[model samples]
Target: MHRFNAYRIFEKEGQVSARLVELGIDDLDPGEVLIRNSHSSVNYKDALAATGTGRVVRRFPVIGGVDVAGVVVTSGDTRFWEGEAVLVTGYGMGVEHDGGYAEYSRVPADWVVPLPLEMSSADAMAIGTAGFTAALAIMRMEQNGLKPANGPVVVVGASGGVGSVAVDLLAGLGYEVTAISGKDDQHEYMRHLGASQVLSRHTLEMGKKPLEKTIWAGAVDPVGGEMLAWLTRTMKQDGTIASCGLAAGIELHTTVMPFILRGISLLGIDSVQCPMALRRSVWERLASDMRPRHLKEMTRTIHFEQLPETFDALLKGAVKGRVVVEIQA
Candidate 1:
């Protein structure tokens, strides 16, 4: 009986289509916690789900958003109660289940994270999966012995969501950050997020050697492929690289010289299906040490009706930073 607005994607005969339509509560997937979705952030995966370009959605008629934050309206689980703010991210949202591109979302209680004490619903999604991924990358680097004093850290695709957040978080932690981006327009924005320097993406392109000059102590890479290959070879001896995203491409073509000779580690990061315990810790840390100083500046708010156009822009890389959809409106 509870009708709401939703962006639903359906696949028929191997073809996918999506549209914003009206649906009722009974149409949603079964779950214990019902969220009145206030905000959901855009991710590259969301674009894939919305447009069906990557076969991301494992099921038909799925909602397409991987992150959501809002107040709980009702709950079947005792661990949560009415009026409590919460967030949901990763774990195949928009890919394998109904997700946050709607005015309401019903998800398993276990998938919910109590919003950090210091973070508001808007701020929670402003960080979204991208910032969470950035936090995870930092955590991975730390576990691999990366320290602020080790030297400068580099973030590739630095104007995009994951890279922007990584740049800000690394710089906030007192590590010098070199941002690699082709969008010259983002230079000042990167600086505002605490980047020590911004390098053109062209600087990392073909240099005709298996190994190049070593400069970075470590790197947070979202633009894999050649950028990852370059980072692998150019990192300082014993350095590590937290590899996430394949915006560039999935294949990594390179020699093993960096790993064998330099002892550099290529650490892969996956926000989806990240352990619940680590998920909670990473989010808590996002409100603390990993919180970017300019998170507000990096977020743009749009309403539910605006999702389609924005999704297109995000896929074309025409949008920068984070985009939070005000689903309820």
Candidate 2:
């Protein structure tokens, strides 16, 4: 391709700015696979990187998207073939390297995952990095003895990308899901995604006791901060909490009583550098059993031109569900 549109962020003179510019293939980083990017997703990290509200981009003048799903146009590695559908996330993507907010993305073959047979390009991006992180969190919890029969699973920050997908996946797997969100208007929407009950964020503020009344069996926590601390205090014995995003805050002020006294497990989820085996497994499960029934309802599609406004909405917490960027459309 001679030229294609990409949203690039540049930091100069201590000011960060982003723009959609036309660039040639030479602008992309070196890699084994070249993808004719079809779709990308707006993640919290993507919002941070594009808006420069946070230090999400370690490199300047880089494309600003963390996830991409599309067709491989060429591949030097034998593991992937031309015309094969693939997806790439994490592993320095959209962080230290150029990423998917473009008409094309050239990435290492090792970073590319062949799209699951059951998933389409749009579907793959719909469940992009945010959904992948949620799936990883649930998978870790399951490995640590979390079962639907055990009890209800609470999803903190339940209206955002990661939290919404977590709620949908857990609910689809027959787990009674309780969604906690600050958005009062989204309570009904949360229930539609299979949450058996919806709780306001204020419900988590049950005082800063080292331990509290045990109510949940497992939790998919993307909110972090005090919400995680509260979940720690209120979890049943042997309960597991998957700590993912820090939408609320990063600091955790709590005692170790939950871990020491109750054998509570805190599984930190890092999707960026997750093992390839696990990454493939998670995507497969997402295409199969863990697939969200309400994916269409939980996602909103936008053209590449909408990224700036979308990022603003995401940063303001005004976006509901996942925001998929249609690169080809």
The TM-score leader among the candidates is 2
lDDT leader: 2
Model 1: per-residue lDDT, tens digit, 82-192?
999999999868888899988899999999999999898888888899989999999999999999999999999899999889988998899999998988878999988
Candidates' C-alpha lDDT? 0.88, 0.92
| TM-score result, candidate 1 | 0.97
On residues 219-313, what C-alpha lDDT tens digit does candidate 2 reach at each position?
99888887888899999999999999888899998898999999999999999999999999999999999997899999999987788899899
- How close is every model to the real structure, measured as TM-score? 0.97, 0.98
Candidate 1 wrong stretches, greater than 4 Å: 203-205
Candidate 1 — which pairs collide? none
Query: Relative to the unseen true structure, what is the C-alpha lDDT of residue 113 in candidate 1, on a scale of 0 to 100?
Result: 94
lDDT of 1: 0.88
